[model samples]
Structure formats: structure tokens, C-alpha cells
Target: MTGRPATTTLWRPTGPEELALVRALDWRAWPPRLPEQPIFYPVLNEDYAIRIAREWNVPHSGVGFVTRFEVRSGFLSRYPVRRAGGRTILELWVPAEELPEFNAHIVGTVQVVHTFR
Candidate 1:
């Protein structure tokens, strides 16, 4: 095996409020999901994330951000990938309670790859 850890790239479309919380965590982890939100979805592709950030998040919050990160493949395998719409619109449905465990498997710091306003 190579020295690098086996990981899968994931992207999240977030609003300013959520991005601020991520920043407060030093970009190391995502904040806990609110009670009403039962799932924490991280999309499989950047295109879907960008679409959400621009279409949904921007309209709701006035600004949005697309963040990318990597997570250990082994840790991610326990959860099934879900297709929300088109073929490319795929995501991992991590239950809110399991989010802490999910965060623990992140391979590196989360990054803001794109922003929309």
C-alpha cells in the first residue's frame, strides 16, 4: 500500500452561519447537526455541491460556500451512498448522531473551494 491514506473526496455546500462554525473549529471538524436535521449529507461530487451552494444556500442566506474534504475510505464504507436526483447527484447520508464519528475519519482539514453570493 502507498504511504498516503486511502480516502474519498467529499464536498459540502454550506451557508455563512455553518461556515463560521467550521472556522471556529479551526477547519478540523463540522459542528453538530441541529435537532431537526436528522442527517448530515456530504455530496460525492463538486458540481452538486456548487449547485446547492449557489441555488439553495445563496438564496436562503445571501451567501454560500462549497467546501471539500477527504475522509478515510474504510470509515466511509459503513454508510451507503445515496442518489438524490441525477446520476451525478450522489451523497453519503451520515446520521446526525454519527457525525462525530464521521468527523473523526476526516483525512485532512476542510477547505472552501468555491463561494457564491
Candidate 2:
């Protein structure tokens, strides 16, 4: 196994603002943000995901959703980490053109963990 850890190392929790993008994707995955938004921010825990969904998304759009998915641990080293208001958020700096490649690293289907409406 190349001596790599046989374990799922990272699960990113996200609140997709574009619900349609989530529905339209193959894995219910979040499509990469626009080129203008070069950083794809995914938090490290479900609680923070839920909080963003409930606090920001629901209030702004009257609907909120939280999704969780496993990603290749090897990719973690490429990004920078930030602590935001009690949340551990990872900054995946994927330019818009490279999104397809990023999506391919996801290990499984993205699961919608919660909905606040």
C-alpha cells in the first residue's frame, strides 16, 4: 500500500449557496467557486457547517444545507489552514480552470448532512 496510511484523513463540511449546483453535480458535490472566488473554503467539522447553514445561508436565502464528504488525505498538504471564529477551515486554492481535477480527488459521494429551512 506504499506504506501510506490506510485511513480517511479529511472530511470537509460545506454549506453550498448554490443549491442547484449541488443537485446538478454527479456526486451532489459542490462545484468549484468562480474564478473570482479562487479559494474553496471547507470547514473541518459538521457543527461549523451546520452553523454556517443556519446562521448565514438560511437568513439570507431562506434555505440552508450542510454537506460532508471524504477527500484524499494526500491533498491536505497542498492547502493552507485558517482558524475562523472557532472553526478550522481549509483554504483550497483551486483556480476556476482546475476545478474538475479537484473534484476527482473526492473519495465518495458527498452526503447532505442537514437542512435548515
Candidate 3:
């Protein structure tokens, strides 16, 4: 809880807008939220991300993005978590401002797995 929580490397699937924003900001960072978006959600694993991308983002937006990044696992505690699919995957909601700190913890490059087009 003091001086940055323990970190873990994790992957998050992103949406087109988030993809564009992160790209504009560089892989090392995440962008600010829109007026209506109080929280920024990043899923906990590749399987979860892919599901969201395919089932939700792709169906609705026609494209979904997959991104890999590292962040503090403990930091996730401060947010609300929704575990699904027999707890094989989860999602966390982070306030917009906290995204900067989250992005700073990335261990390596944030890669685009592919667009689910």
C-alpha cells in the first residue's frame, strides 16, 4: 500500500478508441477519460480480452484490439473487480487519473496482438 503496490505483468484487450489513444500517447502510457467515462477498464488476461474484443467490441464496433502491458497487481485492489468464466478471467475498473501510474509500470513494449476485424 505504501510506495507503489507490487507489480505484475498482464495483458489487456483494448477497443479502437483506446487503441488509438494509447498509440497517440505512446505504449508507456494511457490516455485521460472522456467527460462521461469516470473509470478506465483494463481486463486481466488475454483470454478475457479476446472474448471482450470478439463478443463485444467486434460485434458492436467491428474491430477490437489486444495490448500487452505490465502493472501492479495490488493496485487492482483499489478498484471494483468482476470475475467471470469460473474465475479464469477478471476485469478491473480504474479511475482515469490512476491510469498514468498504471502505464508507468509497463515492463516492456506494449504490442498489438492483432485487430479482430
Candidate 4:
């Protein structure tokens, strides 16, 4: 696929508050598909996506800056090094049409680095 540069939002969890956001994002992104697990899945949800974007704008209380990159489809598989680093993170892929909401869920989680261009 063609490649292009796009901006994304990221967040670094520092404390409980940050962690809570991550948890919340996880829940939103992947709301409980089953009754038993409920909010434990890793699936992507529209609401969660929006939350990620919102969290990206907030100030992080941990190391490294939450960064997002909008690239083509092959970008992720090609640039593993640049995306490497940090611990305890979550990510989700959103279609271009739902980018706004997807971004919200991304930032709310832990450290986010999006690549959708």
C-alpha cells in the first residue's frame, strides 16, 4: 500500500490514574464480548478508540512521550525498530473513517504509537 505521514496521540502511564485510563481504554476498545470475561478482551471498539485520542492530548506522568504515526499498511511490519521500546502498552487499528474515535481509545491506554496513513 502507499505510505504517508500522519500524526497520532500517545500516553505514558505514570501512576494509578494513568493505569486506570489504560484499563478504561482497554474496556472501551474491547468491551466484554462474552458475559464471563467482560472487558478483558483485546478487540477494538469504537468508543475505546475515541477515548484513546482524548488521552493522547493529556499530559503524561511517565517516561517517553506518547507518539502517533499515520503510515501505510506495510509500515508497521517494516518499522518494528522505531516502534520498539517501553513496557506495558496497548494498540488498536482503526479504519480511516473512524480515526477520531479510534484515537481517543489509543491515548487513554498506556503508551500509544499509531501508524495509519
User: Model 3 has how many clashing residue pairs?
Assistant: 0
Q: For residue 5, what is the lDDT in candidate 4? A: 41
Give the better candidate number (1 or 2) by lDDT.
1
Q: Better model by TM-score, 1 or 3?
A: 1
The full ranking of all candidates by TM-score, starting with the best, is 1, 3, 2, 4
* Ten-residue region with minimum lDDT total, candidate 2: 5-14
From the highest lDDT down, the ranking of the candidates is 1, 3, 2, 4
Number of the top TM-score candidate: 1
Give the alpha carbon lDDT tens digit for every residue of 66-91 in model 1. 99999999999999999999999999
Error (Å) of candidate 3 at residue 10 is 2.3
Candidate 4, residues 18-112, lDDT tens digits: the string is: 33554585533322223342222122233343343346423343222222223333333322322122333344333344433443433233334
Which pairs of residues collide in candidate 3?
A: none
State which candidate has the highest lDDT: 1
Candidate 3 structure quality by residue, lDDT tens digits, 15-111: 7887787788766677778889887777777887888778888887888887777776666556677775568687777787777776666555678
Error of 1 at 49 (Å): 0.4
TM-score for candidate 4, residues paired by index? 0.21
Q: 1-117, model 2: which lDDT tens digit per residue?
A: 476443233334434546567678866356767757766776766677777788888888887877777777676556556677644543344456656666777776777778888
Q: Where is model 4 more than 4 Å wrong at Cα?
A: 8-13, 27-102, 105-109, 112-117
